[model samples]
Target chain A: MAGGYVGKILKVDLTTKNVSTEPIDEGVAKKYLGGKGYAVYLLYQYIKEYELKGLSPKDIDPLGPENVLIFATGPGTGVPRFPSPGRYHVMALKAPLTGSIGSGNAGGKWGTSLKNSGFDGIVLEGVSDTPVYLAIVDGKAEIRDAGDLWGRNIFDTTRVLTSVVGGKNTSVTCIGPAGENLVPMAVIMNDEHRAAGRAGLGAIMGSKKLKAIVVSGDQKVSVANPEEFKDVADRCLDALKKNPVTGEGLPTYGTAVLVNIINNVGALPYKNWQTGVNPDAESISGETLSEKYLIRKNMCWACTIGCGRVTNVKSGPFQILASEGPEYESIWALGSSTGVKDLDAVVKANHYCDELGLDTISSGSTIAAAMELNEKGYIPEEDLQGLDLKFGNASAMVEAVWRTAYKVGFGKYLALGSKKLCESYGHAELSMSVKGLEMPAYDPRAVKGIGLNYATSNRGGCHVTGYTIAPEVAGIPEKLDPLATEGKALWVKIFQDFTSTVNSTINCLFDTFALGAKDYGELLSAVTGWDISEDEILKIGERIYNLERVIINRLGFDGKDDTLPTRLLKEPMPEGPAKGQVADLEKMKEEYYKLRGWVNGIPTPGKLRELEIEV
Target chain B: MVMPIVNVSAKILLFATLRDKYGVRELEVKCDGTVRNLLENAAKTLNKGFLARIYDISRNKVREDIIFTINGRNIKDIKGEIGIKDGDRVAIFPPLAGG
Candidate 1:
């Protein structure tokens, strides 16, 4: 039990109503680090054990009682000194959406609270007989009845849980009705607005009949070598404050700042990826949001860069009381992707998604796909239940948010996500997704490196998994031609491996723009007293990434699955700076496979041996 | 004999806080020089503090915080000495970060 971790993992089996605690092996901790990495390792172990018992991968159901959910925190998490220390934890599970490993990280007080409650992680197994919420306080755990809180939205559920739990310091992470209803697009909301918002992790919670987890404690998280840790932590904080992206840009405009920039560059995927640019994109840009809607700025717990937006819309058709964000992804998903130019409507939809416990990206993308279907006469007017689910129909878009959350009429199909919705119509190619998860805002046709990243990402079409956009679009470390596939494979592999480490450390990936791998290594070493080198830290990242890839491979995904939709590959971007461009995936995927020591997107045996992964 | 100087009309585009401060999305500046010279000319329209924000006053180079892209390519890759031709688009943005 060193400085960085509580050194204990809480295991709860709801089917048997049995709970246990196990000591974290120092060797495993050193190799995998924590957060997503730890979760992936644990999942691999679980699956291997199950296989030994004669259970096949095909027999495993993502939403079934056998699926495991891990909420993990890194060594630097909850440490006030680390840069962007507000990032508390990441949740990992076999996603109901992609049916592979699904991981989502959230920044809020909940993670710090979990650490203070004296556990580095929590493993939830089996299915509860009825709706219940887990309450963990100062190392003690309880599976309490949540029958009354079962059907409530995230806002109401949090309120009820806070009052019922009766501790002012208590923080809650819970699912809303969308999760309870088993919507594959459901998200887990923590502290009301922050979400573990991708890959249908919330549906897994719902399937277990788990409503929420409330935690609070007064225990102190102490770092090893306090003096050295303080020095390193201070340097990190100063670097974050001085860095332009973290200090000035993020605080000033929030992430929506990218809307105008991306749009100007012809990379803001619009109207279901039909085009890469939207003329009215400025209507939902960060500038517009800050000018007309931003009430104030908010920050995650212990974060210096307050990039979070607190917005309100008053005296309009899109009037909302107040909400935390309609971040860049949400804006692009609900606004540009659907061709709804009204900022108010997008904001209202964002609020609805947060309250309803839905991943706005998937939900909005699903709706946008349906809108295209409706526009093309594939979905009849009667099929939409008299609602005009047409592109740019702001009113209908807002209504669709509620109906989708409730899974009513056509909303039920929308709740199934864009991939399923499109497949249901016999046009699966129309769904802009990689492996079953809906794609985010950035058009792959415009950014070749990002296209490769999307195709190769282990968790479906996630952007943050690699984020080649930093070099491709923003010129963070250096700028690369967005249209060039040359050397992009090398960059993607480097970024993916590095990102895996960052995600596992459970720190915000935004910190990477400011701090280098050495900075992260220093922080971890100072906190954990592990004496880890930067090279070793990067190797840990590679190991974690390879482990996840192997798990997905075992789940039947291969090079064929590591691909973009036909639209990105075959259809050209009709207008904008990237006109006539398509993702040159074949060229890049080959380089990527070679560089990662992967054959046909599966990690090679030699690569696994090099990473020291047994399976 | 002096060589004939061909002036280039470079469109300058600003984003985010830069846009809010500059009060304009884009402006056209005609100059017969390199990208650095064009930036210097554009700086004439901005206050000294704002100018300093986009350039390293000590290093006499484009500030790392300011991303300057000429023709959709980062000037850092092309370098400031890269010649600018007429009708070239130069985009200036503060460090923009988001998912």
Candidate 2:
């Protein structure tokens, strides 16, 4: 409690309706830090304390009450790099969709506000007897009935809650009807557009009958040494302002700047890579999005990089008049992957998914698979309620979004994710995914280290797990050949550990991309009073990563489970700069195993000791 | 005997700090070899330590924290070996902060 954490972790047991808050020792906080770091520690604590046992016919679902939803924030959050402060990534029960621990970062202010409310994290346990939302402001907290708002989508629910509670500044993280209905791809939405949108953690939240987490904190966050932190932070911010991406390009175009670049690099996986790169990429370019549909831009509290876009569609055949993002990931999934290059169409699809609180990345990916199936005549138009579902059909793209969000007809299967949909279509290999989570925009074969990250991530295929992308694809700090398989395994491993550590600290990743790891240690030291070396910071990452690995492996993902979707390995890039190339997974995996110090892909004893991660 | 290799004209978009860091965005530079040559030439103009921040560090892992997107692919993908072509947009980004 005397260290990085706010000193306490809150646990809500819905089965017994007992609310208890425990103080994590200073020792654990110092070792684990907060946000994602504490999340892993909390996962171990929750699992060790409450393990689900043998099931029964009456068991209903096997994941059971022992599976807790741990939402955590870090100490350096809200102090610098500003924005709701702190990271709010999730660690959920192994979802049926992907069968891995789905933890994703959600922008907006919930994580920062949660910490501001006097607790480092919130662990929702058991299942509630009825529908409710946990409402917390400053240090005051309560679980209020959400019966009236039960069927409401994200937009209406947030509006109602905002009025009922009397504030615009109050940040609300809520699930949509999809989550309320336990759709596997449902996502938790916050600040209207930002979602902790992977692995169906939202479905877990919905199953608990917890609709939203409303938080507003006016209190200032306390750092171990504010003056020292302020100096470093101020210098960092000034330097950031002087740089280009964080300083100019990102602020100017947001992440959409990648729309043109990735498109040109032939990195964008279009229409399931039935075609590798779109010829009419300009239609979906950031310049086009900004010129035609760009409306207003917004930033998360304290975030200096305003990479978030809010836009409006003045006229379209779509119902989505307004929406939040077509963040680089969503743009890829809903746009090129579906063969719909029209930016307006992408925005409309994004709006639909967000309003329903569905995960845009997964939702878009699964629908694209459906469209691919439809194009191949695997399913008919009647299967889509008369919607002419075909790749490149904007109308069908729009329809698929509504159908999946509302779970109408074929949309029901699509909601389960592309992995299952592909299997149903008799082509499970077409899904372009590793774990149940849909792949981000970057093509793995084109970026070697990203492929390694996707294969080894405890959550199955995930970019955030390692983001070897920084080195593998986007030469942010260094250059590497996208076509090369050498040295990538080790690259993915350290990054996974480092990123997990960053997530634990609860800071926005956009910060670390521009700065050094020592600066991170410094910022962290000023918050917790703990002297941590870069090696120690990296070790903390290994600790959380292994902790998550233990959870997912315990839930079924193990050495055998860490694999790329067959599509990535067997299918060569049909066209573009990466044409004729497929991920050389055999060499890559072997190299990765060696770098990880894992014996035949199983974490070695020395490696376990190095991370201090308990098996 | 020495023969001349074909030269390609490239356009790069430099903004704000970099505009000041590098005096010109549209310059006709002839490259007979690799992008590394271009980067080295640009490095000569920048303040000491600035170029090192964007390339692999002394301790190595790559200090090129700056985004040097080739066609939009982070040069990390193609390496510095990507041959330049006429009309290619080779944009280099420094650090940034407005959110």
The candidate that wins on lDDT is 1
The regions of model 2 sitting more than 4 angstroms off are: A50-63, A80-86, A166-169, A319-321, A380-382, B1-99
Candidate 2: global Cα-lDDT? 0.72
Q: Tell me the lDDT of model 1 at A78.
A: 82
- Per-prediction TM-score: 0.96, 0.87
User: Model 2 chain A: which ten-residue window has the lowest total lDDT?
Assistant: A54-63
On DockQ, the candidate that comes out on top is: 1
Q: Summing lDDT over every window of 10 consecutive residues in candidate 1 chain A, give the lowest-scoring window.
A: A84-93
DockQ of each: 0.58, 0.22
Give the number of the best model, judged by TM-score. 1
The Cα error of candidate 2 at residue A184, in Å, is 0.8
Assess chain B of each prediction and give its TM-score: 0.79, 0.58
lDDT of 2 at A3: 42
| lDDT by residue for model 1 (B1-99), tens | 974364878898888888888787888887775655676677777655666678776787788767777765566656335777888887788888788
For residue A182, model 1's alpha carbon misses the true position, in angstroms, by: 0.3
Q: In terms of TM-score, how similar is model 1 to the real structure?
A: 0.96
Candidate 1 docking band: medium
Question: A387-482 in candidate 1: lDDT tens per residue?
Answer: 899899999999999889899988888888999899998889889999898989899888899999999999899898999999988887887888
